[model samples]
Target: MDVRTDEIAEQIYRVSVFVPHAGGGAGFTFNHFLIAGDEPLLFHCGLRKMFPIVSGAIRAIMPTDRIRWLSFGHFEADECGSMNDWLAAAPHAEIMHGVMGCRISIADMADRAPRSLANGEVVDIGGKRIRYIDTPHVPHGWDAGVIYEEVTKTLFCGDLFARLGDGPALTESDIVEPAMIAEDFFNLTSLGPTTAPNIRGLAALKPKTLAIMHGSSFSGDAEGAIHSLADHFEARLRMALR
Candidate 1:
Protein backbone atom coordinates (compact mmCIF):
# COMPACT_ATOMS: atom_id res chain seq x y z
CA MET A 1 0.00 0.00 0.00
CA ASP A 2 1.50 3.31 -1.08
CA VAL A 3 -0.02 6.43 0.50
CA ARG A 4 0.72 9.88 -0.89
CA THR A 5 -0.68 13.37 -0.75
CA ASP A 6 -1.20 16.09 -3.32
CA GLU A 7 -2.82 19.48 -3.41
CA ILE A 8 -5.61 19.07 -5.91
CA ALA A 9 -7.17 22.47 -5.33
CA GLU A 10 -6.38 25.67 -3.51
CA GLN A 11 -5.88 24.72 0.11
CA ILE A 12 -7.43 21.33 -0.59
CA TYR A 13 -5.12 18.34 -0.29
CA ARG A 14 -5.80 14.81 -1.52
CA VAL A 15 -4.39 11.87 0.45
CA SER A 16 -4.50 8.78 -1.72
CA VAL A 17 -3.67 5.18 -0.87
CA PHE A 18 -3.07 2.87 -3.79
CA VAL A 19 -3.53 -0.87 -3.45
CA PRO A 20 -2.62 -3.03 -6.39
CA HIS A 21 -4.87 -5.95 -7.24
CA ALA A 22 -7.00 -5.25 -4.20
CA GLY A 23 -10.39 -5.46 -5.85
CA GLY A 24 -10.19 -9.03 -7.20
CA GLY A 25 -7.56 -8.38 -9.87
CA ALA A 26 -8.37 -4.71 -10.45
CA GLY A 27 -6.30 -2.22 -8.51
CA PHE A 28 -8.01 0.36 -6.30
CA THR A 29 -7.39 3.72 -4.74
CA PHE A 30 -8.94 5.28 -1.65
CA ASN A 31 -8.76 9.04 -1.26
CA HIS A 32 -9.36 11.46 1.54
CA PHE A 33 -9.41 15.24 1.25
CA LEU A 34 -8.16 17.74 3.78
CA ILE A 35 -9.34 21.31 3.49
CA ALA A 36 -7.08 23.76 5.26
CA GLY A 37 -9.05 26.77 6.45
CA ASP A 38 -10.00 28.59 9.61
CA GLU A 39 -11.57 25.37 10.78
CA PRO A 40 -9.67 22.68 8.94
CA LEU A 41 -11.90 19.89 7.68
CA LEU A 42 -11.20 16.33 6.58
CA PHE A 43 -13.62 14.68 4.18
CA HIS A 44 -13.68 10.87 4.06
CA CYS A 45 -11.75 9.01 6.76
CA GLY A 46 -10.61 6.12 4.58
CA LEU A 47 -10.76 2.61 6.07
CA ARG A 48 -10.35 2.11 9.80
CA LYS A 49 -7.30 -0.05 9.25
CA MET A 50 -5.67 2.77 7.29
CA PHE A 51 -6.10 5.34 10.03
CA PRO A 52 -2.38 5.58 10.76
CA ILE A 53 -1.60 6.26 7.14
CA VAL A 54 -4.42 8.75 6.73
CA SER A 55 -3.71 10.47 10.02
CA GLY A 56 -0.01 10.67 9.25
CA ALA A 57 -0.74 12.25 5.91
CA ILE A 58 -2.95 14.77 7.65
CA ARG A 59 -0.33 15.50 10.28
CA ALA A 60 2.14 16.37 7.53
CA ILE A 61 -0.02 19.39 6.65
CA MET A 62 -1.25 20.27 10.12
CA PRO A 63 -1.59 18.75 13.51
CA THR A 64 -4.27 16.07 13.45
CA ASP A 65 -5.54 17.69 16.63
CA ARG A 66 -6.13 20.93 14.74
CA ILE A 67 -8.74 19.40 12.51
CA ARG A 68 -11.99 21.03 13.55
CA TRP A 69 -14.42 19.23 11.27
CA LEU A 70 -14.68 15.62 10.14
CA SER A 71 -17.26 14.99 7.44
CA PHE A 72 -18.33 12.52 4.75
CA GLY A 73 -20.90 12.17 1.94
CA HIS A 74 -22.52 9.08 3.45
CA PHE A 75 -22.23 6.54 6.21
CA GLU A 76 -19.86 3.91 4.93
CA ALA A 77 -16.67 2.31 6.18
CA ASP A 78 -14.52 4.03 3.61
CA GLU A 79 -16.27 7.31 4.33
CA CYS A 80 -16.41 7.35 8.10
CA GLY A 81 -14.87 4.15 9.37
CA SER A 82 -12.41 6.08 11.50
CA MET A 83 -14.94 8.52 12.89
CA ASN A 84 -14.17 7.65 16.49
CA ASP A 85 -10.46 7.48 15.77
CA TRP A 86 -10.56 11.00 14.38
CA LEU A 87 -12.63 12.28 17.31
CA ALA A 88 -10.08 10.87 19.68
CA ALA A 89 -7.17 12.33 17.74
CA ALA A 90 -8.72 15.72 17.24
CA PRO A 91 -10.27 16.61 20.54
CA HIS A 92 -12.06 19.65 19.16
CA ALA A 93 -13.19 18.06 15.95
CA GLU A 94 -16.93 17.63 15.39
CA ILE A 95 -18.65 15.38 12.90
CA MET A 96 -20.67 16.95 10.10
CA HIS A 97 -23.05 15.28 7.69
CA GLY A 98 -26.51 15.45 6.13
CA VAL A 99 -29.55 15.49 8.42
CA MET A 100 -30.56 11.95 7.47
CA GLY A 101 -27.05 10.67 8.08
CA CYS A 102 -27.14 12.24 11.49
CA ARG A 103 -30.48 10.77 12.42
CA ILE A 104 -29.84 7.37 10.91
CA SER A 105 -26.21 6.74 11.78
CA ILE A 106 -23.71 9.43 12.77
CA ALA A 107 -25.71 10.49 15.79
CA ASP A 108 -25.48 7.01 17.21
CA MET A 109 -22.16 5.88 15.80
CA ALA A 110 -20.09 8.96 16.55
CA ASP A 111 -18.70 9.53 19.99
CA ARG A 112 -19.73 13.17 19.81
CA ALA A 113 -22.88 14.71 18.39
CA PRO A 114 -22.66 15.50 14.69
CA ARG A 115 -23.67 18.83 13.26
CA SER A 116 -26.34 17.99 10.72
CA LEU A 117 -26.71 20.24 7.70
CA ALA A 118 -29.86 20.53 5.69
CA ASN A 119 -29.68 21.01 1.95
CA GLY A 120 -28.28 24.43 1.02
CA GLU A 121 -26.98 24.98 4.52
CA VAL A 122 -23.55 26.61 4.61
CA VAL A 123 -20.81 26.33 7.16
CA ASP A 124 -18.03 28.86 7.15
CA ILE A 125 -14.55 27.63 7.95
CA GLY A 126 -12.69 30.92 8.07
CA GLY A 127 -12.00 32.13 4.51
CA LYS A 128 -13.81 29.21 2.90
CA ARG A 129 -17.48 28.34 3.14
CA ILE A 130 -18.96 24.95 2.33
CA ARG A 131 -22.56 24.48 1.25
CA TYR A 132 -24.15 21.09 1.63
CA ILE A 133 -26.26 19.62 -1.16
CA ASP A 134 -28.50 16.64 -0.51
CA THR A 135 -28.08 13.85 -3.05
CA PRO A 136 -29.86 10.91 -1.58
CA HIS A 137 -29.73 7.58 -3.47
CA VAL A 138 -27.82 9.09 -6.33
CA PRO A 139 -24.71 7.08 -5.64
CA HIS A 140 -26.49 4.38 -3.63
CA GLY A 141 -26.67 5.87 -0.15
CA TRP A 142 -29.90 7.18 1.35
CA ASP A 143 -27.98 9.72 3.44
CA ALA A 144 -25.65 10.77 0.67
CA GLY A 145 -24.83 14.44 0.17
CA VAL A 146 -21.98 16.51 -1.32
CA ILE A 147 -20.35 19.75 -0.25
CA TYR A 148 -19.39 22.74 -2.36
CA GLU A 149 -16.59 25.04 -1.32
CA GLU A 150 -17.75 28.50 -2.22
CA VAL A 151 -14.29 30.02 -2.53
CA THR A 152 -12.67 27.53 -4.88
CA LYS A 153 -15.86 26.37 -6.59
CA THR A 154 -14.79 22.84 -5.70
CA LEU A 155 -17.32 20.11 -5.06
CA PHE A 156 -16.35 17.43 -2.57
CA CYS A 157 -18.31 14.92 -4.57
CA GLY A 158 -17.79 11.55 -2.90
CA ASP A 159 -18.25 8.63 -5.29
CA LEU A 160 -20.05 10.41 -8.12
CA PHE A 161 -17.13 10.32 -10.56
CA ALA A 162 -15.22 7.40 -9.10
CA ARG A 163 -12.82 5.49 -11.36
CA LEU A 164 -10.48 2.57 -10.82
CA GLY A 165 -6.70 2.31 -10.17
CA ASP A 166 -4.30 5.07 -9.16
CA GLY A 167 -4.79 7.80 -11.68
CA PRO A 168 -3.40 11.31 -11.60
CA ALA A 169 -3.90 13.36 -8.49
CA LEU A 170 -5.76 15.96 -10.55
CA THR A 171 -6.56 15.94 -14.21
CA GLU A 172 -8.32 18.11 -16.72
CA SER A 173 -8.69 15.04 -18.93
CA ASP A 174 -12.06 13.41 -19.53
CA ILE A 175 -13.06 11.06 -16.69
CA VAL A 176 -16.51 10.17 -17.94
CA GLU A 177 -15.29 7.05 -19.71
CA PRO A 178 -13.25 5.78 -16.78
CA ALA A 179 -16.09 6.53 -14.43
CA MET A 180 -18.53 4.65 -16.63
CA ILE A 181 -16.18 1.68 -16.69
CA ALA A 182 -15.98 1.66 -12.90
CA GLU A 183 -19.76 1.99 -12.69
CA ASP A 184 -20.14 -1.09 -14.86
CA PHE A 185 -17.90 -3.12 -12.60
CA PHE A 186 -19.04 -1.74 -9.24
CA ASN A 187 -22.63 -0.84 -10.10
CA LEU A 188 -22.45 1.77 -7.37
CA THR A 189 -25.20 4.04 -8.64
CA SER A 190 -28.73 3.69 -7.31
CA LEU A 191 -30.58 3.93 -10.68
CA GLY A 192 -33.55 5.36 -8.79
CA PRO A 193 -35.90 7.86 -10.42
CA THR A 194 -34.43 10.70 -8.35
CA THR A 195 -30.85 9.85 -9.25
CA ALA A 196 -30.83 11.81 -12.50
CA PRO A 197 -32.45 14.85 -10.95
CA ASN A 198 -30.05 14.73 -8.05
CA ILE A 199 -27.10 14.58 -10.42
CA ARG A 200 -28.48 17.47 -12.48
CA GLY A 201 -28.67 19.51 -9.32
CA LEU A 202 -24.95 18.96 -8.78
CA ALA A 203 -24.18 19.89 -12.37
CA ALA A 204 -25.99 23.17 -11.81
CA LEU A 205 -23.19 24.16 -9.44
CA LYS A 206 -20.70 24.30 -12.32
CA PRO A 207 -17.90 23.23 -10.07
CA LYS A 208 -14.34 23.69 -11.29
CA THR A 209 -12.83 20.92 -9.19
CA LEU A 210 -14.40 17.61 -8.22
CA ALA A 211 -12.86 16.15 -5.06
CA ILE A 212 -13.64 12.48 -5.48
CA MET A 213 -13.12 9.71 -2.90
CA HIS A 214 -12.31 6.51 -4.71
CA GLY A 215 -10.12 7.83 -7.52
CA SER A 216 -8.43 10.85 -9.00
CA SER A 217 -10.04 14.24 -8.54
CA PHE A 218 -11.23 15.85 -11.76
CA SER A 219 -10.72 19.39 -13.00
CA GLY A 220 -12.25 21.25 -15.96
CA ASP A 221 -15.79 21.16 -17.38
CA ALA A 222 -17.02 19.52 -14.22
CA GLU A 223 -20.56 20.60 -14.99
CA GLY A 224 -20.41 19.00 -18.42
CA ALA A 225 -18.98 15.78 -17.02
CA ILE A 226 -21.72 15.62 -14.42
CA HIS A 227 -24.43 16.11 -17.03
CA SER A 228 -22.87 13.40 -19.17
CA LEU A 229 -22.99 11.03 -16.21
CA ALA A 230 -26.59 11.94 -15.52
CA ASP A 231 -27.54 11.27 -19.12
CA HIS A 232 -25.84 7.90 -19.08
CA PHE A 233 -27.57 6.80 -15.88
CA GLU A 234 -30.93 8.13 -17.06
CA ALA A 235 -30.68 6.18 -20.27
CA ARG A 236 -29.71 3.03 -18.42
CA LEU A 237 -32.65 3.43 -16.03
CA ARG A 238 -35.10 3.99 -18.87
CA MET A 239 -33.88 0.90 -20.68
CA ALA A 240 -34.03 -1.20 -17.54
CA LEU A 241 -37.55 -0.11 -16.80
CA ARG A 242 -38.60 -0.80 -20.39
Candidate 2:
Protein backbone atom coordinates (compact mmCIF):
# COMPACT_ATOMS: atom_id res chain seq x y z
CA MET A 1 0.00 0.00 0.00
CA ASP A 2 1.29 3.44 -0.85
CA VAL A 3 1.50 5.97 1.93
CA ARG A 4 -0.42 9.17 1.19
CA THR A 5 -0.65 12.59 2.82
CA ASP A 6 -3.46 15.18 2.65
CA GLU A 7 -4.52 18.53 4.03
CA ILE A 8 -8.09 18.00 5.22
CA ALA A 9 -8.74 20.84 7.63
CA GLU A 10 -9.37 24.48 6.66
CA GLN A 11 -5.58 24.67 6.21
CA ILE A 12 -5.04 24.32 9.96
CA TYR A 13 -3.40 20.88 9.83
CA ARG A 14 -2.21 18.11 7.55
CA VAL A 15 -2.20 14.34 8.02
CA SER A 16 0.69 12.18 6.74
CA VAL A 17 -1.08 8.90 5.93
CA PHE A 18 0.96 5.67 5.93
CA VAL A 19 -0.63 2.47 4.58
CA PRO A 20 1.01 -0.80 5.62
CA HIS A 21 1.08 -3.11 2.60
CA ALA A 22 2.18 -6.08 4.69
CA GLY A 23 -1.43 -6.64 5.80
CA GLY A 24 -2.21 -8.43 2.50
CA GLY A 25 -4.84 -5.88 1.46
CA ALA A 26 -6.04 -5.93 5.06
CA GLY A 27 -3.65 -3.00 5.32
CA PHE A 28 -3.49 -0.55 8.19
CA THR A 29 -3.00 3.22 8.24
CA PHE A 30 -0.90 5.50 10.43
CA ASN A 31 -0.54 9.27 10.56
CA HIS A 32 1.57 12.21 11.67
CA PHE A 33 -0.08 15.57 12.36
CA LEU A 34 1.50 18.81 11.12
CA ILE A 35 0.52 22.43 11.69
CA ALA A 36 2.18 25.84 11.60
CA GLY A 37 2.28 27.80 14.80
CA ASP A 38 4.60 29.89 16.98
CA GLU A 39 6.06 26.39 17.30
CA PRO A 40 4.76 23.52 15.21
CA LEU A 41 3.94 20.02 16.56
CA LEU A 42 4.49 16.77 14.64
CA PHE A 43 2.73 13.68 15.98
CA HIS A 44 3.60 10.00 15.35
CA CYS A 45 6.67 10.24 13.14
CA GLY A 46 6.67 7.06 11.05
CA LEU A 47 9.57 4.86 9.84
CA ARG A 48 13.03 6.16 8.86
CA LYS A 49 11.83 6.98 5.36
CA MET A 50 8.85 8.74 6.87
CA PHE A 51 11.09 11.60 7.99
CA PRO A 52 10.98 13.01 4.45
CA ILE A 53 7.29 12.19 4.33
CA VAL A 54 6.75 14.24 7.50
CA SER A 55 8.88 17.12 6.21
CA GLY A 56 6.96 17.21 2.95
CA ALA A 57 3.65 17.13 4.79
CA ILE A 58 4.72 20.05 6.95
CA ARG A 59 5.87 21.98 3.91
CA ALA A 60 2.48 21.33 2.35
CA ILE A 61 0.70 22.57 5.50
CA MET A 62 2.96 25.40 6.58
CA PRO A 63 6.69 25.56 5.95
CA THR A 64 9.62 23.14 6.05
CA ASP A 65 10.98 24.89 9.15
CA ARG A 66 7.71 25.42 11.04
CA ILE A 67 7.87 22.38 13.37
CA ARG A 68 8.75 22.81 17.03
CA TRP A 69 7.46 19.65 18.67
CA LEU A 70 8.06 16.08 17.46
CA SER A 71 5.89 13.87 19.63
CA PHE A 72 5.28 10.11 19.74
CA GLY A 73 3.12 7.60 21.66
CA HIS A 74 5.96 5.39 22.87
CA PHE A 75 9.27 3.96 21.66
CA GLU A 76 7.76 1.90 18.86
CA ALA A 77 9.17 2.05 15.36
CA ASP A 78 5.87 2.37 13.60
CA GLU A 79 5.38 5.50 15.68
CA CYS A 80 8.77 6.88 16.73
CA GLY A 81 11.74 5.56 14.72
CA SER A 82 11.92 8.75 12.74
CA MET A 83 12.13 10.92 15.86
CA ASN A 84 15.91 11.09 15.82
CA ASP A 85 15.76 12.03 12.20
CA TRP A 86 13.13 14.68 12.96
CA LEU A 87 15.42 16.15 15.61
CA ALA A 88 18.07 16.55 12.96
CA ALA A 89 15.66 18.11 10.48
CA ALA A 90 13.83 20.54 12.73
CA PRO A 91 16.41 22.48 14.71
CA HIS A 92 13.83 24.03 16.99
CA ALA A 93 11.43 21.06 17.39
CA GLU A 94 11.51 19.37 20.76
CA ILE A 95 11.03 15.62 21.10
CA MET A 96 8.02 14.94 23.34
CA HIS A 97 7.47 11.52 24.91
CA GLY A 98 6.79 9.80 28.23
CA VAL A 99 9.40 8.83 30.85
CA MET A 100 10.84 5.76 29.19
CA GLY A 101 10.91 7.31 25.76
CA CYS A 102 12.97 10.08 27.25
CA ARG A 103 15.37 7.67 28.96
CA ILE A 104 15.91 5.60 25.83
CA SER A 105 16.31 8.62 23.64
CA ILE A 106 18.68 10.29 26.03
CA ALA A 107 20.93 7.22 25.91
CA ASP A 108 21.69 7.79 22.24
CA MET A 109 20.86 11.43 21.76
CA ALA A 110 22.30 12.74 25.01
CA ASP A 111 22.37 16.32 23.79
CA ARG A 112 18.67 16.25 23.08
CA ALA A 113 17.00 15.94 26.47
CA PRO A 114 13.35 15.30 25.67
CA ARG A 115 10.69 17.06 27.67
CA SER A 116 9.08 14.36 29.84
CA LEU A 117 5.32 14.56 29.47
CA ALA A 118 2.80 13.21 31.97
CA ASN A 119 -0.95 12.73 31.74
CA GLY A 120 -2.84 16.04 31.63
CA GLU A 121 0.30 18.12 31.19
CA VAL A 122 -0.26 20.76 28.53
CA VAL A 123 2.39 21.86 26.09
CA ASP A 124 1.92 25.25 24.55
CA ILE A 125 1.91 25.40 20.75
CA GLY A 126 1.68 29.12 20.08
CA GLY A 127 -2.00 29.80 20.85
CA LYS A 128 -2.99 26.13 20.73
CA ARG A 129 -2.52 23.70 23.61
CA ILE A 130 -1.60 20.01 23.44
CA ARG A 131 -2.21 18.00 26.61
CA TYR A 132 -0.71 14.61 27.27
CA ILE A 133 -2.83 11.65 28.44
CA ASP A 134 -0.90 8.58 29.46
CA THR A 135 -2.13 5.18 28.21
CA PRO A 136 -0.05 2.49 29.94
CA HIS A 137 -1.37 -0.74 28.46
CA VAL A 138 -3.80 -0.34 25.64
CA PRO A 139 -1.53 -2.89 23.99
CA HIS A 140 1.26 -3.14 26.57
CA GLY A 141 3.76 -0.38 26.02
CA TRP A 142 4.72 1.35 29.25
CA ASP A 143 5.54 4.83 28.00
CA ALA A 144 2.46 5.08 25.80
CA GLY A 145 0.49 8.33 25.99
CA VAL A 146 -1.73 10.52 23.75
CA ILE A 147 -1.96 14.24 23.05
CA TYR A 148 -5.23 16.16 22.96
CA GLU A 149 -5.92 19.67 21.72
CA GLU A 150 -8.88 21.16 23.57
CA VAL A 151 -9.67 24.16 21.38
CA THR A 152 -9.51 22.20 18.16
CA LYS A 153 -11.20 19.11 19.62
CA THR A 154 -8.46 16.94 18.15
CA LEU A 155 -6.94 13.89 19.79
CA PHE A 156 -3.58 12.57 18.67
CA CYS A 157 -4.54 9.16 19.96
CA GLY A 158 -1.51 6.89 20.08
CA ASP A 159 -3.20 3.57 19.51
CA LEU A 160 -6.38 3.54 21.60
CA PHE A 161 -9.15 2.69 19.10
CA ALA A 162 -7.15 1.29 16.24
CA ARG A 163 -8.20 -0.76 13.18
CA LEU A 164 -5.88 -2.42 10.68
CA GLY A 165 -7.36 -1.20 7.39
CA ASP A 166 -7.03 1.53 4.76
CA GLY A 167 -9.26 4.01 2.86
CA PRO A 168 -9.60 7.63 1.66
CA ALA A 169 -11.85 8.60 4.56
CA LEU A 170 -10.07 11.01 6.94
CA THR A 171 -12.89 12.36 9.12
CA GLU A 172 -16.13 11.23 10.78
CA SER A 173 -18.45 12.63 8.11
CA ASP A 174 -16.68 10.35 5.69
CA ILE A 175 -17.95 7.28 7.46
CA VAL A 176 -21.28 5.62 6.72
CA GLU A 177 -21.92 4.08 10.17
CA PRO A 178 -19.56 4.93 13.01
CA ALA A 179 -20.72 2.05 15.20
CA MET A 180 -19.59 -0.39 12.53
CA ILE A 181 -16.23 1.32 12.54
CA ALA A 182 -16.05 0.77 16.29
CA GLU A 183 -16.59 -2.96 15.81
CA ASP A 184 -13.74 -3.23 13.39
CA PHE A 185 -11.70 -1.04 15.72
CA PHE A 186 -11.87 -3.83 18.27
CA ASN A 187 -9.96 -6.01 15.83
CA LEU A 188 -6.79 -4.13 16.77
CA THR A 189 -7.36 -4.41 20.51
CA SER A 190 -4.53 -6.37 21.95
CA LEU A 191 -5.48 -9.36 24.10
CA GLY A 192 -4.09 -8.96 27.62
CA PRO A 193 -4.87 -6.92 30.72
CA THR A 194 -7.56 -4.37 29.81
CA THR A 195 -6.34 -0.83 29.22
CA ALA A 196 -9.64 1.02 29.66
CA PRO A 197 -8.50 3.24 32.50
CA ASN A 198 -5.56 4.59 30.59
CA ILE A 199 -7.81 5.35 27.64
CA ARG A 200 -10.39 6.87 29.98
CA GLY A 201 -8.09 9.78 30.78
CA LEU A 202 -8.07 10.80 27.14
CA ALA A 203 -11.81 10.10 26.84
CA ALA A 204 -12.58 12.54 29.64
CA LEU A 205 -11.23 15.35 27.48
CA LYS A 206 -14.16 15.16 25.00
CA PRO A 207 -12.21 15.07 21.78
CA LYS A 208 -14.41 15.81 18.76
CA THR A 209 -12.14 13.89 16.43
CA LEU A 210 -9.49 11.24 17.04
CA ALA A 211 -6.56 10.90 14.64
CA ILE A 212 -5.80 7.28 15.46
CA MET A 213 -2.47 6.09 14.11
CA HIS A 214 -4.02 3.04 12.49
CA GLY A 215 -7.14 2.70 10.39
CA SER A 216 -9.39 5.71 9.64
CA SER A 217 -9.80 8.45 12.22
CA PHE A 218 -12.93 8.94 14.38
CA SER A 219 -14.67 12.10 13.31
CA GLY A 220 -17.83 13.48 14.94
CA ASP A 221 -19.19 11.95 18.16
CA ALA A 222 -15.53 11.43 19.01
CA GLU A 223 -16.23 12.13 22.66
CA GLY A 224 -18.90 9.47 23.15
CA ALA A 225 -17.13 7.01 20.88
CA ILE A 226 -13.91 7.38 22.86
CA HIS A 227 -15.71 6.78 26.13
CA SER A 228 -17.27 3.65 24.65
CA LEU A 229 -13.80 2.48 23.73
CA ALA A 230 -12.69 3.19 27.27
CA ASP A 231 -15.65 1.22 28.61
CA HIS A 232 -14.78 -1.66 26.31
CA PHE A 233 -11.23 -1.74 27.64
CA GLU A 234 -12.33 -1.64 31.25
CA ALA A 235 -14.75 -4.50 30.72
CA ARG A 236 -12.14 -6.57 28.94
CA LEU A 237 -9.59 -5.86 31.64
CA ARG A 238 -12.03 -7.01 34.29
CA MET A 239 -12.86 -10.13 32.29
CA ALA A 240 -9.20 -10.99 31.80
CA LEU A 241 -8.23 -10.65 35.46
CA ARG A 242 -11.24 -12.60 36.65
Highest lDDT, which number? 1
lDDT tens per residue, model 1, 81-163: 99999999999999989899999999999999999899999999998898998899969889999999999999998998888
Residue pairs in steric clash, candidate 1? none
Please report how far candidate 2 places residue 134 from its true position, in Å.
1.6
Estimated TM-score for each candidate: 0.98, 0.82
Local lDDT at 103 for model 1: 99
Candidate 1 — which residues are off by over 4 angstroms? Answer: none
Worst 10 residues of 2 by lDDT: 174-183
Q: How high a TM-score does candidate 2 get?
A: 0.82
User: Which residue pairs of candidate 2 clash?
Assistant: 68-93, 172-219
List model 2 lDDT by residue over 95-187, tens digit each.
877776577553455336788886678877886788877666555476667777766777877766565566654666533234336445455
